[model samples]
Target: MTAPETVVPTGKSGIYMPRRSLLMRIADMRAWLFLVVLIAFFEVWSRSAYGVSFILNTYNLQSISVFATAPLLLALGQTFVIISAGIDLSLGFVMGLASVIAAHVANYAALQLGLPPLAAMLVGMLTGIAMTIIPGLVNGWLIAHLKVPPFIGTLGMYGVARGAAYLFAGGMTISVSNSWYSTIGNGRVLGIPVLVILVAIACLIMHYLLSQTRFGQHTYAMGASQAAARRAGINVKKLTMKIYLLSGIMAGVAGVLYTGRFSAGAAQAGEPLLLDSIAAVVIGGASLFGGSGTILGTVAGALVIAVIQYGLVFINVEPFWQFIAVGTVIIISVLVDQTQRRFTGGRQVE
Candidate 1:
């Protein structure tokens, strides 16, 4: 009798099993492991420094929610652009411009046009989105059609958007009089902060977009190898434009939220978000080289940042030290990213 024929799994199953090992999975999820470690460290530190009850309080959770919301949104948007091997340096300035435009337009619509508060707020939201989107389109044109490097194109827009914000607000803060404007920033639903809820919803939507959509596949392909993606029939230029446009729209939404939180908009209001968002993205384990990122990771990174910030304040650390600490963390994150890339032969962790 012939020896029993041995059947070996080939193709998909063959490729998947080795990668499905526990060690491989752990290696793939090093970022999440780091996040968990950071969280545990912070939890211990906070309890020791501020007392366990204070650290565990619902109010403290709400405070972190407030601090994390803006950065979380910006990082989520940045993830889309970064995954396509691009960056949007204009995000912070675009947000400032949006906030200024929204505040002024909403005030005008409510006071001069005699619109209802809710109607005026809606107009403001639309204005913010438009203002933000226009710059994104311009950025797209510069980078895609004009062949400008993303850094240069977005850096130029960064300055232009900041200037526009200042010009629009006349170098002053524009206050919003309508109470409804603050609803999104301050109100809560079902005992959760509105900002937290918004962030959660955005995370879910973006997670779905990245994981389940063709656009996301295209994005990853482009990031992995632009030449390969082009050869495979991807429309590189249009996709690039759409990515930046989405980034700008998210910035606009963040702007509106900022205005709601403050009841006013200032030209420089979003300046701080620039570093924070980038830091969050990096800390979340998204490679600066692109092709890998996750919304959940970004959220965790945002929370980490917020926790550290609040924890430092609770421990009475000085303000300047906070900046130094954040900068240090960012550098460490970049180093970790570089190490991972080197070890993995440039394969990015997902």
Candidate 2:
């Protein structure tokens, strides 16, 4: 049988080394690893200062997860937009809108009108989406057509979205009375909070899209070289528009979660989320310059921020120091991103 068709081992081409690129494979796990390190540190600190059991009580289940929700959502949203070489500064405001919309929809009147509890919940989130789409459209038009600076364009939307948020709420908070409405925000699945589940799933979906799909390839292509992407017939403008839209959609989803968790929608519902969200993306080792961030990196970044915040609180570190510490982390994260980019510097052929 011709020696049973003895075959030679293939080279790198045949190696199933890793289907995931360097960044995609560990994006979420990296975030979790950061969490693990923080947990270890906290365990040590607690042993030294408060004793191990006290540490356990302080590093309690609720505390760890509570700090994570906002940052995780915000990071995911920021990751996609930044990869497209853009940013959405209005995310906090969209979160505020989410709070308002959810509360507004939760109104007994809307409930009486036959709106399902889930539909009511969605209404709150829809505002985040609108804010994203509107300014994303603006950002796209300016950057793609008008050639306006992405920084200035998105920054302007930030102010505008915040203003609209106040207008929508007239500076008030709203809440829902439906028990079912509360279930989503406050419920658990397999011992994991629903919000956590949602965020985790989103990470998976985004990571896959970024790593495996044609659109993702085009996204990097556009960021790396818009002209080249156009030359490659990548429909750069459409991609830009879609990317911004996705950013808005994420913010809106976060809004829904926020509304449910707080059981209220206020004009300022999502303010704190802004810092952690951007911080997470930065921490995850994604370049703000587009063409570089991986979803895995963003998740890591988010966890980093969450851990810092959690660590500070658990160790009784001053809250103000948390802010200062996070700012420092952001600088460090950016530096790391720059360094990796420099190391990888070459004309991106694909």
Candidate 3:
């Protein structure tokens, strides 16, 4: 939270230096704080109610990580889009489309073409991911070239992707017999899930992109003010396209992983995850208005949701309460953002 200080002239030959107060520093780490608080709450609840430890249990930790994988992948892309002051409502359905496509293509490659299981699985994954580029391009065209609003453009694509997924799936779940694919989804290395490791690598790449690259700087500039960015010679349109395309690719990866994990593909594979992805971005300290967020924060936000979902189930709470809990956290995150913005006179701290 230690930003470049602005010094003002004082009448008595002294400089007046302005610095972020302790509260502002605390606000910057709000996502992590929320995560810690939730974990502590769950641990205490488990200890008191069931005479068991939550965090100390290895199974609970693994379960939470498993629960977090898909949504975290979806949210990683979302963090970028939101930072660019845009949203991708189509990601959920896009993921479903990829899942169905992967299953179908994998089946064909194996059963019809007589490909090896591993080869078929790889083909299916590559093909499924490639198909997502179509929607990504269309979304980019609509929003960037045609000047369609992000919300309307993405929402329209959402329906299109969903319908296509169902049609391609023949309104039924397609099963995959490839053990290799399933292993990618479920197998672990050194006691960590493969999916978790994949997501961690993705997170690092995204974090570097957002924090250390020129593209990241341009994204923030555009989100803060497109007109100003244009004036500064930033290609807002191109950036917009890249942002949405990236979002689609992320969703596609999530979908492929979903199919691998379940050993089946359904049109509704990602239906419930859309909300969780958005919630993770918001709760991770990203501003809905634009121009502020971090991949690390999104990770914390995803973990927060995962902990809530898994912890509730462990405690035998009704599943329906998970939505309420997530919604409440989102609201608090937004309120905190607003309050912090007001205190900073509408300036976003890096």
Candidate 4:
């Protein structure tokens, strides 16, 4: 019997870096650079005094930046799913359910009867976790056991989850009755929005999970080929379940954060998030076909989407034009992915 090999070391500074290490580093830098350039671009545009008067408004800048943080979290989760040769349309709906949990926690009859606040929050988080687990399990079942196509399986789950959200909340907007609940969502840390901080933390954890963990290693292997992965003794079924489980957990967290910021829970919680998350993952350099991508790429993709949406508002563009702009961004990103695929595929053939 032999232990499975998962990681290789690349010596630093005095030693030449390995190609894989270099590629990974390049990917990380590219994602961060994308975000930096975008923020800078918008900051300059806001100061241009001629390009977009709306951009110059401090209140709008803060609002746009804060809102971007939520979608960015979704993008990070989507990036992981796509790289591992999967998709999750349920992220939007899962978020809605989580939002409901957050709202209902503070309103619990037991809590109102003098139960501790922390206990209520813990209860909410647990509920959110369970919500994500079921869909992920189903996705895993359909994809791994039933041999269903990832796209269609997840798309079906998407509709099912949204309906569940509506049912769970009785199709009405639910809000927290406590000031403590509102504080967590709307509060800032060191002059930065708490939601943005949460997104950054989520990205960091996910990056390490994808880049350094054993589970993450198998993720790529299974994505590269289930047959090969199984031959290598990797548990494809287990890994598939775990991956979708992770997607659900992340979506659940995002949902909670969004509920906090909005101070309400609604069935429509994450409707616009579905395509944007996919776009973020695609933009981050994760391929639809699976086997390649980084978390950094996802955050970058998300920031790009956020900037474009914000930039539109800054320019006083009509509200409806936002969809057109987002569609253009997604198309451009996918085109880039296809072009890269073709070039690499040709080289391999040659």
Best by TM-score: 3
Error of 1 at 102 (Å): 0.6
Model 4: clashing residue pairs? 284-297
| lDDT tens per residue, model 4, 158-235 | 889888888889989887655545566787777677777777788899999999998888898877777889999998
Better model by lDDT: candidate 2 vs candidate 3: 3
lDDT by residue for model 1 over 87-183, one digit each (tens)?
8899998999999999999999999999999999989978987888898899888988999989899999999999999999999999998888898
Q: Which candidate is the best by lDDT?
A: 3
Query: Candidate 2 on 78-132: residue-level lDDT in tens?
Result: 7877777777777777667756765776664455677776665555455445555
What's the true lDDT of residue 302 in model 3?
96
Q: Which ranges in model 3 have alpha carbons more than 4 Å from their true place?
A: 1-16, 348-350
The positional error of residue 170 in candidate 3, measured at the CA in angstroms, is: 0.4
TM of each candidate vs. truth:
0.90, 0.83, 0.95, 0.83
Ten contiguous residues with the weakest lDDT in model 2: 341-350
* Candidate 2 C-alpha error for residue 177, in Å: 2.0
Backbone clashes per model, in order?
0, 9, 0, 1
10 residues in a row with least lDDT, candidate 1: 16-25
Q: What is the C-alpha lDDT of each candidate?
A: 0.82, 0.70, 0.91, 0.74
* CA-only RMSD, every prediction: 4.1, 6.6, 4.5, 6.5
* Model 4, residue 210: C-alpha shift (Å): 0.3
